[model samples]
Target: MLYGAMKVSVGAGLKVVFRPRVEGREHVPARGPAILASNHLSFSDSFFLPAVLDRKVTFIAKAEYFTSPGVKGRLTAAFFRGVGQLPVDRSGARGAGEAAVRSGLEVLERGELFGIYPEGTRSPDGRLYRGRPGGLARVALASGAPVIPVAMIGTDEVQPPGKLVPKVLRPGIRFGEPLDFARYRGMEGDRFILRSVTDQVMYAIMRLSGQEYVDVYATVAKRQLAEEARARKRKSAQE
Candidate 1:
């Protein structure tokens, strides 16, 4: 009920104001379980993709969004739930990854579309980072669903991090053809197969988004950048 209402109200407002350019929407299956694997560029990537899709796409959000206290917290949690977001505790990396896979499989079993960011986190920079093989690959192989590569173009420019208001510029969404990994269906337990499947999906996203490919994980890139900044600060202090 709330999902339909929000889709009509918020989705309509977004289309009117931003006028997002969407393409290849036909690539999405009309009624079946499929994975929408996308490159994570901005916070708004989650909102814009679901708004434009006719079918509901369920994504995992951090548990804090659902567990915070106070009136504002409750309202925020309600909003996220209304939009079909499931909360997962992300404090432990291994546990979180396993939980996410479980959540995704459950959604797929219901014959619903499950949306995921293969990169695990948003790109610290605009470049495409390597996909984590554990969650996305496991769910794809386990559920045997077609993986659709989605590109959210110019979303970083429209709503960069820490920006209160988005710029009134057009963002684009391109859906690539669905990829099937049926040959590797029963090999989800194999680490090598997992990495191979994940790399294939990342390659498709890179082609669609036209972002520079970074072979490292986004979290590693973020840590390296932070270390560089601290090193510069230390050098300046010593000078």
Candidate 2:
């Protein structure tokens, strides 16, 4: 209700000035369980995609959002939840990946749509990073749901980093066909197997969207810097 209504009113108004062209919306399933996997470009991409998507797609969100302090935090949390976001900590214990996959699987098992950013986090470089494979393979193998590869062009320019408000700019969303991974269904849990399936899905997105691929997990690179920061703090305390 809130999503569709907001999209209709706000989206229409926005389009009058800065129109956003959407393509391949037929790719999104009108109903049933499917994965809307997209490349992470900008923060606004979250609201933008959901606004354009006809269905009530649920995306995996960080758990910290819910626990945020003060009124501002409360509003932010409310809006995200109101828009159908599920909380899952992506930076906690080693089991974070498994937990998120499990959450998404639960949604699928209930015959609901699940959304995920395969790259794990936003791409600072505008280049699609190598996905973590995070349970995408296992989930597909388990649920038998079709994966819809989505690509958002001009989003980065619409709302770049360090900008609070979106520039009165317009960007477009180009959705691709839903891809079936039934051929690899019978394959065992081999790393190579998972990587191949992930790449194939990403390739579909890459072809439709035409973004540069990074071949490295965005989370892994962030993890390195985070670890270094922690180590530095520890050394400072000890010295």
Candidate 3:
């Protein structure tokens, strides 16, 4: 109820004011288990999807957002929990993939919506990087749920890196047709097969978003860049 309502109200407002257009909304199931596979561009990408979606799609958030220690923490926790966000430890300590897959499948079994960023992390340079066959394929295979490919474009401009507050820039969301791996129905636990399915879903998102696609995971590139920048700064200071 809150998810659908927020999506309609906020999404409509953005459309009227900022002219952010959303396509393929019909792809969203009115009720039933489904996966929202999208490209990770901006943090606002998380906010905007629920605001515009008709169904309540529950997202898994970072542990910090749910574990903060004050008024801000309380507010953040309340807001995220209210919006149906769950926190999962992404540090991948133990049984990381299995844990997330279990959580996602449980939600699907309960006939609820689950959201995932296939790229695993945000695109470092505003480009759609490769997909990590994270438990997404497992969840889909386990629940037989259709993965809905979503693309959020220009949200980076709305909330760029290092920005404390969001600027009122136009943002657009496009939902591609839901991807079903019915063909691979009995093939769970096959890493190679799961990766192939993920690639097809990601290709759909890349086409919808028009961002250049990188063959490697987005986070890997971001980490390397950060290291290189730090090294360059150190050398410059010495010079």
Candidate 4:
């Protein structure tokens, strides 16, 4: 199968090239359904995380990655599929959240590993932003799976936002102790409980990543930066 072959080939190739140092992998459950909740830094976060793991970690990706047209798009789609990523429509926030949770639940029900980013989007400034919950709480609660906090250090520098090729930099992957939310089992509908659970996960990630914590969402931070850039450009033009 393409998945098996690529997993071995890609994993071997990356080990030789990036020489990633993975720590705390012992925390990942060798078998059974578990949530790998991590801080997103670069596009390579998905690839690097799964590459290091012995088990196949499936993550929900944007549908555009699968639905793009033409030869290049097909290759991209195939590559994502080969690497065990599921495509979900990320259009409306509410709808997309629901769809992703549903897909994740299905994966968990099958007793497989599911990966998610608690921060919703990559940190634009490398500071760990406030987690969006983004149904991560709901999924973990619903699936009754232990949440493993993972940190992908130095990935942003190796393959930054706009870069396609990665530099031969050693990134570290650390997995923290698994967090159990058994007490909040039946309270998935509680927004306050969700926020609390998500914050706890983010805190664990912060400790592992050693990145400065920002109180705002990454998307909001990016928007603010864009607006500030526009304002500066306008002021310069007027001057």
C-alpha lDDT values of all predictions = 0.94, 0.79, 0.83, 0.93
For model 3 the local lDDT of residue 185 reads 78
Ten residues in sequence with the least summed lDDT for candidate 2: 3-12
- Candidate 1 local distance difference test against the native: 0.94
lDDT of 3: 0.83
lDDT tens digits, residue span 69-180, model 2:
9999998787777677878776765578778878888989988878888787888778888876756766776677899888888888888877877777778788888888
For model 3, give the 10-residue run with minimal summed lDDT: 2-11
Local accuracy of candidate 4 as per-residue lDDT tens digits, 178-220: 9999889878898999999999999999999999999999999
Q: Mind giving the per-residue lDDT tens digits that candidate 1 earns over 1-239?
A: 98888888878888899999999999999998999999999989988998898899999999999999999999999999888899999999999999999999999999999999999998988999999999999999999999999999999999997787999999999999999998999899999999999999999999998999999999999999999999999999999
TM-score against native, each model: 0.97, 0.84, 0.91, 0.98
**Cα-based RMSD of candidate 4:** 0.9
Off by over 4 Å in 1: 236-239
> What is the per-residue lDDT of model 3 for residues 1-239, given as tens digits with 9 covering 90 to 100?
65455566665776566666778889899999999999988887877887676667788888789999999998888777767788887677356666678889888988988988988878889998988786778788778999998999888888887786878877888988888898887687798988998899889999899989889988789999999999999999999
Better TM-score candidate (1, 2): 1
Winner by TM-score: 4
How badly does each model clash, as a count of residue pairs? 0, 0, 2, 0
Best by lDDT: 1
Residue pairs of candidate 3 with colliding backbone atoms: 7-51, 7-52
